[model samples]
Target chain A: MLEDIVLGLGMIFTPENLFWAFFGVACGIVVGAIPGLSDTMAIVLFLPFTYYLSPIAGIALLMGLSKGGNFGGSIPAVLFNIPGTPQAMVTTFDGYPLAQKGLAGKALNTALLSSVIADACSDLILIFLAAPVAALALRIGPPEYTAIIFFSVVIIAVMAGNDPCMGILSVGLGLLLSTVGTDPHSGSPRFIFGFYELADGISLMPMVIGLLAFSEALRQAYGWLKRQAEGREEPPVHIPGNQGLRWQEFKQIAPTIARSTGIGACIGIIPGIGTTVGSYLSYLAAKKCSKNPERFGQGALEGIAASEAGNNAVNGPNLIPLVTLGIPGNLAAALVLGAFMMKGLIPGPTFMQNHAQLLYALFTLLFFSNLFTFILGKFLVRYAGTLGSIPETLLISMVFVFCVIGAYAANSSLFDVFLMFAFGLLGLALTALKFNLPTMLVAFFLGALLEGKVRQSLAISNGDFMIFFTRPVALVFISLALAMMVYTFAKGFSRRRHTMSH
Target chain B: MIRGKRLLGLGVLVFCLLLWFLIIPNQTEGKTGAEFPRLIVLFLAIPGAVLLLRSGAATGAAPLKGEELYALRRTALLLALVCVYMLVIPKLGFYTSSILGMAAFLYCLGVRTPLQIILTPLISVGLMYLGLGLGLSFRMPAGLLP
Candidate 1:
C-alpha cells in the first residue's frame, strides 16, 4: 500500500499528467461557473475528446472537472442570485444575501476555502478507506444493488417537493422514458415508435440539456421580457471588497464545514443520493447546529461554508462506486465510465489489480485538481463581476444557438433536433403543471440502473420475492426506504394539520 | 391554472391507461425475466393520475393574472423563434441561420438597439463558428449557401 501511494505520487507529478490535470480544472471551473451548464454536461461534451488521450489522462481530466465544477458552482451562487448547479442552490440561501449586503468577496472567499478543505479531507478519506468500502460493496449482489437504488428513488421522491404523488408520477414517467431504447438482453425494440434513432433510446445528453438548460433558458427569457415590458431596470451590481477572513469568523464556521463535509462524503458514497441532497442536508444540519439559526438564510458565512463544503466533498467519494464496482454513481460519473470503456478499460473488482498504477495516478490528479481550483478561484473571484454582467438578451440568444448546435452535434440527426425540441416542450409543460423537473430528471437517470439490477436480482432468485428480504444488506436498505417514506408522509400530514389548525 | 392542470391530468391518465393496456402485454414475456418491478411503475402511475385529477378538481379554475399571461406569451414567442431557426438552419447554412436565429431571439427579448441588432448576431455566429469549427474541430453543416 505504501509503495502504491508512492508510485501514485510519482505518476501524478509527471509533466503530462500535471498539465492535463490543470487543463481539466480550468475547463471545469469555466463550465461550472456558467449558469445552466453542469459538470455532467461539461464531461459529456468532452467525452468524445477523450478518445485520443491515455486512460490515466482521460480519467484525470474527468476527476479534475468533477472536483473543480463542484467548487466553481459556488461562484455564481455567491455573486449572482442564480445557482450554477443544483448543488449550489443551498449556497444561494445565504450567498446571494451576502452579495446583496456587499460582502460578496467574503462569502466567495469562505466558500472557496471550505470547498478546498472539504475536498481535500474527502479525497484523503477515499485514499485510505476506499479499499474497505469496495470490499464491502463487492459483497453486494444484484438484489442489494436493487435495494440501494430503490432506497435512492424513495429518498429523491420524498425530498423532491411538497407533493410526493407528483414526485412518484415523475419517477414513473422517467422509467417509461428509459424504456424507449432497444432492450439490451433480448434485442427487441421497446418504445422506439417507428424511428430508428429511438432504437438507441433518447440520448441522455439531449434529454438533460433539454430539461435543464433549455427549460431554464425559456424561463429566464420569460422573466427577461416581462422585466423589459414593465420598464424595470436591474440595479447595477456592487462588487464587494476583501475584508480578509477574520479568525473569529473562522472559529464560528469551521465546525460547520467539517460536519458538512462528513455528511457529504457519506451521501456521495451512496449511489442515489446525489450532490444536491448532500448540499441541502448539510445546510439543514448547519442551520440546526448554529448558535443563531435565525441568521441562516440571510448572508451567514456558515451557510456558505456548509453548502460549499458539502457539495465539493461529493467529488471524491462519488467515484467510489464507479472505480470499485464498475457502476457510476451519477450521470457525470456514467459518462466517465463510458470514457473508461472507450479506452478499453473496465472498472470492477479486478480493475485495481490490473490498473493500480492508473488508479493511483487518477487519485493523485484529483488531489492536484483541488489545489488548482484554489489557485484559479483567486483569479476568478476578481473577475466574477464580468460573468454576472453579461446582457441577458445576448446570453439567451447565444445559448439558443448552442442548444441547436449541441443537439445536432450529438448524433448528426435532424430527428434528434426535433426530439430535443419535443422534450423541451414536454419539460415546459411539466413545469407549468407544477411537476418537479429535477426529481423527474434524476429518476430518469436512475431508471435503467434500477431496472437492470431488479431484473438481474429476479433472474438470480428464480422469481422468489424473498431474495430482497433474505439478504441483510438488502433488508436494511429496504427498511430504511420504508422508514423514509413513512417519515416524509408523517411530516407532511403534521404540517398540513398545523396549517389547518392555525 | 386549474383547467390546465385538469387537462394535463386527463392527458397523462389516458396515456397511462393506454400504456397499461398496450405496452404491458407486450412486456409480459420479459416479465419472468424483468417484469415485476415494472408493476410498481404501473401501479404508481394510476394513483398519480388520480392525485393529479383530484388536486385539479379541488382547486377551482382561476384565470391567469396579467403577469402570468405575459410570461406565457413571451415563452411561446421564444419557442416559435426556435422552431423557425431549426426549420431554416438546414436550408440557410449554419452561419446565416445562427445569425438570423440569434437576432430574432434578441429582438424578442427586447434588445432593440440598431447596433445590437447587427453586432450581436454577427459576433454570436462568428464566435460559435470559430469555437466549434476551428477550435473544437467539430463541423457545422454548410447547407444551401455552401
Candidate 2:
C-alpha cells in the first residue's frame, strides 16, 4: 500500500495531470455558476474530450471538475438566492440573507473554506476507508433506504417553512408532481395528459431553473420596480468591511464543517440518496445542535458552512460504492464510472488488485483538485462580488434570459420552456404563500427513489407492512423521524403558549 | 393571509380527492400502480386538514395595495412577455425572439433609454451565440430567420 501510494503520488504530479486538473477546475466553476448547467452535464459534455488525453490526466480532469463544481454552485446561491445546483438550495437559506446584509464576501469565503476542508476530509476517508465503507453501504436495503429518505423528508418538512403544515403540503405537492409520467412497476403512463413529452415526466433542469432562477428574476424585478415607485435606490450587495471571513469566524464554524462532513460522507456512500439530502440533513442537524436555532434561516455563517461542507463532502465518498462495488452512488459518480469504463478500467472487487497503483493515483489527484478548487473558488468569489455592482434590472434581465436558454437547451424542446414558465409562476405563488420551495424541490428530486424503495420493500415482504419495523436499521430511522416530528410539534405548542401568556 | 392559507388547504383537499377518484383511475393501470399514489394522496390530505384547522388562529396582514399592486402588475406584464417570447421562439428563432424579448423586458422595467434597450439585447444575444453556439455547440432553434 505504501509503495502504491508513493508511485501514485509520483504519477499524479506530472505536467499533463496538473494542467488538466487546473483547466478542469477553471471550466467547472464557470459551468457550475450557470443556472441550467450542472457538473453532470459538464462531465457528459467533456467526456469525449478526455479520449484524447492519458487515462490518469483525463480522470484527474473529471475529478477536478466535480470538486470545483460543488463549490461553484454556492456562488450563485449566496449572491442571488439562486442555487446553481439542486443541492445548493440549502446554502441559499442563509447565504442569500447574508448577501442581502452586505456580507456576500464573508458568506462566499466561508462556503469555500468549509467546502475545501470537508472535501479534503472526505477524500482522505475515500483513500483509506473505501472497502469497509462500501461493505457497510451494501447492507443498506430497500427498507433502510426508504426509512432514511422518509426521515429526511419529515425533518425537512418540519423545519422548512414558517408553518410546518405548509412545508408538508409543499412536500406532498412535490411528491404528487413526481408521480406524473409512467408508473415504474406497471410500465404504463400515469399522467401524460396526451403530450408525448410528458411521457418521461418532468425534467429536473426546467423545474429547477424555473423555480429558483426565473422566479428569483421575477421577484427581483418586482422589488426593483417597487423601490422605483418609492423613489429609493437599491443598495449594492457587498459592504467593504464585512467582506472577509476572520480566523475567529472560521474557528466558530469549524465544528459545523466537521459535523456536516461526517454526515455528508456517511450519506454519500449510500447509492441514490444524493447531495441535496446530505446538505439538508446536515443543515437540520446543525440547527438542532446550535445554541440559537432560530438564527439559521437568517444571515448565519455557520449555516453556510454546514451547507457547503455537507454538499461538497459528498463528492469524494460518492465514488466509493462505484469503485468498490461497481455500483455508482449517484449520477455524477455514474458519469465518473463511465469515464473509467471508457479507459478500460472496470470497477469491481478485483479492480483494486488489478490496478492498485492507478486507483491510488486517481485518489491522490482528488486531494490536488481540492487545492485547485480553493484557489479557483477564491477568484470566483472576487468575480461574483464585482457582479453585485451591476444594475439590478440589467442583471435580472440577463438571468431571466439565461433561465430561458437553460430550460430550452436541456432537451431543445419548446415544451420544456413552457414547463419552465409554468413552474416559474408556481414558484412565485408558493413564495407569496410562504411555502418552502426548496423542500418542495428536494422532495420532487427524491420522491421517485423513495417510492421505488418503499414499493420494493413491500414487494419483498409479500405486501406485509411489518417489513419496515422488522428491519432494525429501518426501525431506527423511522423512530428518529417520529421523534423529530413530535419534538417539532411540542416546540411549536410551547412557543404559541409563551406568546399567548406574554 | 389566513384566508389564503385556508383556501390553499381547501385546494389541496380538493386535489387529493380528484387525484384519488378521477386522475389515478383514468391514468394508471394495474393494482400496484395506484397504491403508492393513493398513499401519497392520504399523506397530502392530513396536512391539508391540519392547515385548515390551525390557520383560523393565525393573524392576517394587510392586502396588497398601491405600489404593491403596481409592482404585481409589472410582474404580470413581465410574465406575459416571457410567455410571448416562448411562443415566438419556435416561429422567429432563439436569437430574434431573445432580442425582442430582452428589449421588451427592459421596456417593461421602465428602462426607456433607447441605447440601453438596443445594446443590452444585442450584447446578451451575442454572448449567448458565442457561449452556447461556438463554445458548447448547442444547435439553438433557428426558426424562420436566415
Minimum summed lDDT over a 10-residue window in model 2 chain A is located at A233-242
Screening candidate 1 with a backbone cut-off below 3 angstroms (N, C-alpha, C), the clashing residue pairs are none
Which 10-residue window in model 1 chain A sums to the lowest lDDT? A43-52
Candidate 2 backbone collisions, by pair: none
Question: Deviation in angstroms for A36 in model 1?
Answer: 6.5
TM-score of chain A of each: 0.84, 0.64
Model 2, residue A156: displacement in angstroms? 2.8
Question: Model 2 segments beyond 4 Å from truth?
Answer: A1-115, A122-131, A236-369, A377-385, B55-58
Going through the candidates in order, their DockQ values are 0.48, 0.60
**Residue B63 accuracy (lDDT) in model 2:** 88
Q: How far in Å is the alpha carbon of A388 misplaced in model 1?
A: 1.0
What lDDT score belongs to each candidate, Candidate 1 first?
Answer: 0.76, 0.79
User: Fraction of native contacts in model 2?
Assistant: 0.80
- Per-residue CA lDDT of model 2 for B1-146, tens digit only, reads 56677777888899899999999888889767888888789878977876565433556787887888899899899989888988998889988888989999999998999999999999989998996678667777899877
